[model samples]
Target chain A: MLKIDCKDKHFSEIGKTIRESKDKEIVIDNCLGHRYIASGVGGKDIVINGTPGNALGSYLDGCKIVVNGSAQDAVGDTMNDGIIIIHGNSGDATGYAMRGGKIFIKGDAGYRAGIHMKAYKDKFPVLVIGGKAGSFLGEYQAGGIILVLGVNTDSKTNVGYFTGNGMHGGKIILRSDELPDLPPQIISRKANAEDLQEIEKYVQEYCSYFGGEPKDIMEKSFYVLTADSANPYKQLYTSL
Target chain B: MAINYIYPVYEVVRNASRCVNCKICEKQCANGVHKFDAKNGIMIADESKCVNCHRCVATCPTRALKIVKSDNTYRENANWSAESMKEIYKQAESGGVLLSSMGNPQPLPVYWDKIVINAAQVTNPSVDPLREPMETTVFLGSKPDEIVRDKDGKIVDNMTSQLKLSTPIMFSAMSYGSISYNAHASLAKAAEKLGIFYNTGEGGLHEDFYRYGKNTIVQVASGRFGVYKDYLEAGACIEIKVGQGAKPGIGGHLPGTKIVGDISKTRMIPVGSDAISPAPHHDIYSIEDLRQLVYSLKEATGYKKPIAVKVGAVHNVSAVASGIARSGADIIVIDGFRGGTGATPTRIRDNVGIPIELALASVDKRLRDEGIRGNVSLVVGGSIRNSADVIKAIALGADACYIATAALMAMGCHLCRSCHLGKCNWGIATQVPELVQRLDPEEGCDRLVNLVNAWTHEIKEMMGGMGINSIEALKGNRLMLRGVGLNEKELEILGIKHAGE
Candidate 1:
């Protein structure tokens, strides 16, 4: 494993140093507020000691990244085919426009997490927020799975307002007794046995990343929010 | 539902002597404008269904067809026009926002027509492009501030990202889903033949066109559709579509009907689902955020490709261009208000954004003043009609010109402004199997190549006439240009002297 101390290093330098590494497994120390460190990087294992900046694993493909501390906004942005596990909480847009891959945040997430995330064929991105999430969660989500655990939060609400706004496809699993005031475009339901079984792999994997009992976490009734895909398209111009 | 609506603006007039009952117009009209009335035993024209696309006229074997403006008129008032009244009627009936296709049809100021070029007089002699070498080749990207010489006296070049073009023109972005697959084929083939690039627009690049990767510039928009590792790697350059001039500050919505089959697969969205590109990239709320995305694309491609940020030419266009220049982008494309779109709100298309001519001049001046002109290349796109428009754009401080409407016209688009309907009979902007197949790629490519070839030749001749030898010499050389029928303010904005000065 190639280890480098990224103290006082610019985002570009960190990116370059990480890029120059020949080792498949690399460790970054003192990774304070450095943005776009492993952006579009894949085929390697990256372990971050401290907070990495926004857009940390943007466009990431087929790699595994572990963050010892919290991460900034836009973590795992538009990332595809990768695994990013953040031990601490994440900021806004945790999985912004992510098409594929799985991002496991150990704690609460800020606003707009999992916004515009999509899935195609076998590439279904899974973003599991361990704690309560902020407003506009899963907004305009075309596809993919976003699961918010609400693990340990004092807030009465599991998630914030405008959840799943303008969402067209995919499934959002929220582990909460009741959902917040939702938009007209979205529908929420209690997770059935089939739904629980469907998210079993992700729950198990998320638990592996940040220790938790799968049975206890999975026991609670999960709220599944989805876009009303039944909304038919109307021509704004002329009908004929 | 209220049923009474205004008749179409035009009437399809058929010459009886030339009408052979071929029924080609009846068969060819995608809008169902013409149909053989079996009960009447005659082909009847439905004016309301006609978009005035001229598909019938063009395809008429004996030149039997002509579309004339209907002699229908309400109480004519300049303030409330017939179209406005019709629009009100439309809204009252459907309660739907008025959506339009292509550029603004309103009588807005077209700065291109008001600008003119100066010819070589007594002091300077015009060179013959045929006899002498008049270079039209342009290299788009960052240029070195100053040349460095090595100990051996060889000039060391620092220019890393550059798109070498035989002409100062390129086909602007028109996505596969927005246009037909055959239309894309024509553009790719033409770009390859012309040694210029064609943009993939916000639409994802089709799989078959991956072979034309060398001539393609893949686009990443807010929707992030079909943007993957292979797609990013396929393009010679990548463009982040921040905004389009036609619909400024608003996202794009490709209706579900257009997303069929391969288009659905190419865009990576579900078949027949609306492909909505949000107004803002949720992550990018600032210039710094744009820089991050730019760097991400660069890192993805190992920094081998240049990143271009395409933004609408808004009121703060110069400042926006400056920000993009500082945003780690190698190229900046400012699409002016006259630029075409697959679909945009009619109000937004007509009212929003400034003209390209004004935006280009302002951006060039601002960049030059900021001493960052060499940091990024400027590409101007918005109704670049002919060689003169391209030359004028170059003089106004553009490295290259991107032509979408002009290119489409060359590929047999009559500009009916009905692209939103997705029933293009010319096979240019539809996804239906029959319509998409109507545009033969070979013929499309030939026409496109022919158009650009003529434009380049004209550019060379015009450059020669100005006593200019190279595109590099002519670019941002405002002295060679002048404004005609323009006020002092217009002249000042255009950075040119009046004609006969």
Candidate 2:
């Protein structure tokens, strides 16, 4: 256990030192508004005891970053392949435009969660939010799987307004019976047998990461599955 | 029933006595209105083909030609006029939308024409171009904040890389798909010949044209179409197109109709599918994110090529430019609202961004005030009409100017503004087989070479008239320019003065 107290050091500097260090198990204490912490790391186990700033684990290749506190906007942005476990709530644009990787948030995510998240062949990205999300949850999402589980017992609606706008491809699973007020471009339905089969691995991974029973969450009831319309962007711009 | 006869609606008359047979008017008339018939003793006029561009009237040596509306009559129906009915019938038959090009040429106020330039007489000493070497060559790159040297008394490290050019003029990006192959060839050849650079608009570079890589500025837009390692490494510079002047808030859509064999292969998309470039880059959400992309591309290319960020000249452009300058961009290209495009929504095209003049002035002033002007170079474009406009642009603090419409005009565009129809009679804008064949690359390149050469001489003459020798000396030299009929706000925004006041 290597513990480093980042009292007054800039987040970038501390992150650089941590990344350069050969230590596998590292703990960063008193982390206050430090940006790009544990960014672009290859293989390391980083635990943040305090609040980290924006762009946490950006372009992370193969690292496991666990944040004890909430993070700022653009957490795990464009990360290729990594695992980010946020214990608390996150700011807006969480997992934004992520290409590949898995991000597991124990708490809620802000607006535009997984916006434009994409995946190529053999590289599928997964983002699971334990609590509710704000508006425009998956705007312009081209590929990948995004699941929002309203584990916080206070609310039932896991996602907010205009969800899945301009979504051309991909699947979104919401652990809520109430259908979200979505745009006209997206088609929403109860999780069918086929949809459940597809998300089985992702749900199992989410359960494994958060130490929750996958059967308990799955047996409770319906999941809202959203996909883009056949002609999602047909009339979005102009008549001509 | 006998058909009602109507005389000609308009007559294009030519006075043979005043005609000098120089053919300047004939050459200038791109609409094929006037042509010399070898079989006949006099020049022949075609009335139906005339769009009344007045090029003949402007270029006639003896003012020999005149245009008049003929006193012809049709069944006077205000809503269902003969022309309107014909247009409706054509649309009903073809089932196609109407498309136009260039600037809004329908009697709209051209701010460029309204604005005028000033000269130095007795009050300020304009340097003599004949005696002194006027510095027209501009280095577009980041400048050093503080020089660092080693103990050996030699300069060790500089701040930013510079793009050196012989003249303060560049060919703006016109993608391969948007224009014909011959047009791209002509532009590429001309840029190589003139020692300037031409931009390969977001379309990927063809394999054959890679030899002109030194003279090309490859563009990367949201779609990331044709963006490969080689494409990034193939150019002298790379431009990240955020938004265009013609349609600021909209993305690019190459209709399925234009997606031919080579274009489909180059764009890496299926044929008959619309090539959609999203409005915003999926990776960039803020200025810091934009910085990341800039650096990422730099890293991908090993920092050898200069990276340019091209944005529309919108309101608050100064602040936007300030952000871009600090965002590690090497060059900031501010495209004015009047820039040309192959296709754009008419509503957004006309109403989206600010004029180039005001945007350039504001951006230049903002960067200079921050003392970070050396951090990035500024290139302004929208509608640079002539050499005079180029001189004025540089004096207003632009490192260079970009000319697309002017270049098209040199290649025989009639300014009909019907490029979207893809049936350009002049062969300058269309990609149709027949229309494309009209423009020969060799001849087109020669004409472009001739146009720029003429403009270079005229630029030198203009500099000489101001007694300034080089373009560098003329940069931000607003005192050499004065505004005519411009208000205080216009003068302040343009950073110039009223003529002779």
Cα lDDT of all candidates, in order?
A: 0.88, 0.77
- The number of the candidate with the highest lDDT is 1
Q: What DockQ, between 0 and 1, does each candidate earn?
A: 0.53, 0.08
List per-model TM-scores for chain B. Answer: 0.97, 0.82
Instruction: Residues A160-238, candidate 1: write the lDDT tens digits.
Output: 9888888888889988777788888788889888998987777888888888888888877788988887233354454
TM-scores for all predictions: 0.97, 0.72
Tens digit of per-residue lDDT, candidate 1, span B1-501: 434567679999988778888899988888898887789667779888888999999999999999999989988798998888888888878778888899878898898898888779889898889999888888877777788999999988766778888898999988888899999999999999999999998778888999999999999999999888889999999999998878879998787777788988898877777887888998889998888888878877777888999999999999988999999899999999988998888989999999999999999999999999989999989889999999999998999999999999999999988898889989898987888787999999999999999999999899899888899999899998888899998888888999889
The whole-model C-alpha lDDT of candidate 2 against the native structure comes to 0.77
Fraction of native contacts (fnat) of each candidate = 0.40, 0.01
Weakest lDDT window of 10 consecutive positions for candidate 1 chain B: B1-10
Q: List runs of model 1 lying over 4 Å from the truth.
A: A230-240, B1-3, B146-157
TM-score of chain A of 2: 0.90
lDDT of 2 at B382: 92
What is candidate 1's local distance difference test score?
A: 0.88
